[model samples]
Target chain A: MEPQNAREKRDAAVEARVHLIVFRLGEEEYGVRIDQVKEVTITPEITRMPKTPSFIKGVSNIRGDIIAIMDLEERFNITSAARDSRHTYTLVMEAKDYTMGFIVKEVPQSLSLPLSSLDKAPSFVQDFNISENFIEGIGKYENRLIIVLDIFKILTSDEIMELKS
Target chain B: MKSREQEYKEIFVAEALEYYDALSRHISELEKTPEDEQILAEIFRLLHNLKANAKAIGYLVIADVSHKLETAFGMIRNKELSFSDEVVTVLFDGIDMLGELISNVDGAKEIEPSPALLRNLDIIINTQTDNNTELNKVQKYYTSKNLSLSDLIYIQIKKLDHLLNLVGELIIDRDRIVSISKELDNDDLKNVSAHLYRITEELQYSVMDARLVNVGSLFNKFPRIVRDIAVAEKKEINLEISGQDIQIDRNILQIITDSLLHLMRNAISHGIEKADVRKKNKKTPQGNIELSAQNDRDTVILRLKDDGKGIDQQEVRKAIVQKGFLNADAVSDLRDTEVLSFLFEPGFSLAKEVTEVSGRGVGLDVVKNAIDSIGGRIKVDSKKGVGTTFTLYLPTSIAVKGALLCQVEENFYAIPLMHTDSVLSLPTEKLHEVGNLLVTDIKGETITVVHMRELFNNDLDTYNGTKTALEGDVQNIIIVTYNNRKLGLIVDKLLRQQDIVIKSLSRPVNTIDIYAGVTLLGSGKVCLVLDVAAITRYFIARR
Candidate 1:
């Protein structure tokens, strides 16, 4: 009986790892662990801080606290689509020790898939060089390569320190 | 629609309060020096303006009182009545009653002046007939003194605030030229920049000067506060005020009033020793508390000092432990500055018992919070059994100039340069991973690294798509300090630095809290400005 309970616990842990928050950026959809997402909000006024990395959009006041906003289009080397009044949404996620904002092309949707279902990207993917540090693995979903993100590796220690400060 | 009416009422209330405040000061000045024709004329004009505004607003009771006050002032203006201490006192009494009526206008309760106050007013009017000769003599005396009565006008504080704000916007516009010149890289641009710089500097100075108001307007209420608090505490205290002519922003002046009043009350109740104690300590029986303001560099330093037994550090330490705020081990390592700061901690009090006066333990914390909310710092210097002095250092203006704009993922943010510490270009080689966390050393301080892209949950593909690193020599890092804690943020680009006029984000955007305000750059693109303090608090709370 104890062994069966232990197996159930292991299964639950495995189940929790399957779901991801997937969102569109430029023309591509990317996924991050669902657990890291805080909330989605409308893009707000982003105050620029001096001497930050080029990809950081700036910072915004969220409620009474300030949170950093990052420009995914710039980070991913994609040309920003012409901003219509309704173009972007702010995806708030807990990264490192702070809540930061990401500008995305569209609102994100959540999806669930077993970890075993994910397949490694083929070596021939053209954009693999720039995304090498960011993508953990690619999963086949609806005949598309859904890049799974390894968020922890996206920024260096100094960059993280800069945002934290 | 309901909110609109409420907003109008608020405006009316604010206007009414200004009239009351002016009336109080004018009446006090008249009482002190009754022969000053200029002051009398000023008082008359204020009453007339109040009467007109009250009638326009349909506040009939206030209008009626204002009309009567105007009539009374007119009699003095025409030399039909004499200036006397008794008459001045009656005028001050009427002003006080008007203040109460104005303050209570929004409340459901109806307030009426006391019978005694009414009787005094009647006496003042009745005395005018017999005092006609004395009035003539006083008018002759004033004429001999060559004092001319100046017509008075009442300017709404809101209008003044608006004017100041417009000036602030102009300053930003002027600052943008400097940035524009840097981008153009031409002789014509340089000439235009030099020309814009001079004109803007002059305009900035003149506009800043316009916002400068004499601090006496704030100090006038303190004497009454000290009197009330001293009487309540059964203490003998004399309040000394200096540098009343020193000018500061009206907005800042308004904010500091309540905080200053609280400090004065605290001084009377806790800082000023009792008469017996003072005598025993070889000090004067009547304690003296001095409140002074002076300009120090670009900051205004207001100091409140009292000669009394200073704060007991031991008691503060014990209070910290008693409140369960700190453990024994932490207490042992605490410095005096840290202990002093514990007074600002919410719900921490050293008072033995809650008193109707100062011992409630809420006053100091509120004072500290008020000062901090305005980006001001408060320092408490106390010598045990000697005295205590609280010095507040505040920026001369709340309006900021140019802000540094940076991008994280695709979102833009601005940081006010006034509060900005420094910006560094982070080298990848210096980044180190500690366990699962990234850390970096900056100026000998170990700082945590935050990934801009991940924190905002930006789609990795968009980030990767924009991964073209600028052909820059090094990656940039922005270091910002909010409340003394430093944060370093990494961003994708260092865009053009320009002066952007901060426009407050409306409604839903405001609710987000991370953005302080929005501004339009030279190209008229709206950008979000970051609230550094809010971001810092958010980071700390999440950590």
Candidate 2:
């Protein structure tokens, strides 16, 4: 009975797959857990909010609710390619009790890969000045490498509130 | 699935909190009329049930405290003992300790009642000769099963908050559709949209109304708080509360609860004089504190008045001068009311000696901040020989705010009507400079006027000395007030006055205090609501 149970556990582990919504920031591809992305739509008109950091592009009206729109490239300190604003999309994300949107130039695509395809990120990724907390791992599917992002870690729960003080 | 033990603990905690509130209310009422047998019996019954409930949950400490308390009440019911000051103090301590134990039952380790508290209860129990078996029999007859039953369900407040948010979204959509129907000028669409609008409006109000709890739910707890402070200070304070049936949004009540408690303690400690002092002043020996609420137009006024020695303006002025807040010459020029307003300044205390209850260097400024955060205003009025009264003007509901939409340059902003006093256009010549500050005179009062263009342009930088050139010959100024101070916010034009559902700016944008929150305009554009309190404070601090 023990051997049979162990075999079943191994089979279940092999069947585990991680589904991610892949989007582009600058030249690099980033993937966030599919469940974290609530919806993706064309970028709406954003009203500039004064006194906020540059990364916070502004607040926008999304389906009658005001959501703060953040420039993902600016947040990650990546030099923007200065893409046309009309062609960009806003990814509405649910992050830790808060709903926010991120602006991306390219449309996001969903992909599901087996657990075996995910691996620990290389140390050089940290050298780019992105906190290791923001990276879930590296996903290698086919010949392309996708940087699995931990959406919840991009903004710490108390980070914004702490700045207010 | 939650374990049975976990489920039981949750139920126990919720029921225990309700019992605590009910018990506190009953105990305070009992103190007021010690001979009222009905209230006494009710208290005894509640204690008995609490004891049983605690014991069944294995909260030995809570059960033991409740059992002793129940026994004392039972003896009191049998005419075995009288309600003396000592008995009152011990009874209050037991109830307070029980509250602490019940609240901590969810902790990793159980909290044991202090030895002294247990000893006090033991002394009270030992004073009785009989075990009161007859009273015990009567209590057993009136068991939990015999109590009146109500068909009610407990809801998590978080769910109500979410529903309120969804309702807010529907209201916004209803407005959007109504506007679209008007633009299209389609008869059938307009008719259908009109019907939809009414339904959405009714739904909006119903959802908000569900959250409107009686102010009494909050005001009832105060009798005990006042009792505790009155007993400790040895002052005879008769807290007369009325208009408790008036309802308010529970969220607003929660925000202002601590501020009200702080104000109450201040009244008992600082405002009210000693009994002998009152007698010397040709006043009744018992001080009176009237805490009443009344409805105003779209606002609720909570008034806390005390018939005690009113604020001594002379002492306040002296303190102001001594503290170097202002020189004697300038302080003397200020009016009596102006000097009194300084009582809310940070670290400003007139208490010669720090007492256990208050005067720990935390002044009314913290209370002012709390009120300010809720977009409410507080004003203090006192007549030196008569009394002191604090009138707080608060909005009826926080879900939607009445705001004046104004345009600054090209951006649209909404200033809450609660803070907005009036709007008028002033010619450029009316604006003058007092020293280095821009001051505009309106009705003999000089209010500092800062152009919104400059104020919003500087990111987190408060009013700088740089004076921007006025563009137009006429400047439209919106008079905004916070606390007792007022400022004139110069805007380009006033769009319209409308009810706006304020949506809090999440994350990074929330750190910006100048804007309270963002709201969606009827045109589907996001508009920021100006934080009048923050702007007024910044303007005042710069002066």
Which structure among the candidates has the greatest DockQ? 2
- Best-fitting candidate, scored by TM-score: 2
Error of 1 at B52 (Å): 26
- Tens-digit lDDT track of model 2 for B40-110: 98888888899898888888778888999999898889888778777787788788777767766768976
Query: Candidate 1, residues A73-138: lDDT per residue as tens digits?
Result: 787787665656565778787766556677887778888877766766556555553456567778
Candidate 1: TM-score of chain A is: 0.75
Clashing pairs for predicted structure model 2, backbone only: none
Every candidate's DockQ is 0.03, 0.36
TM-score of every prediction relative to native: 0.51, 0.72
Error of 2 at A13 (Å): 12
Estimate, for each residue in B500-522, the C-alpha lDDT of model 1 and write its tens digit: 55666432224444556776554
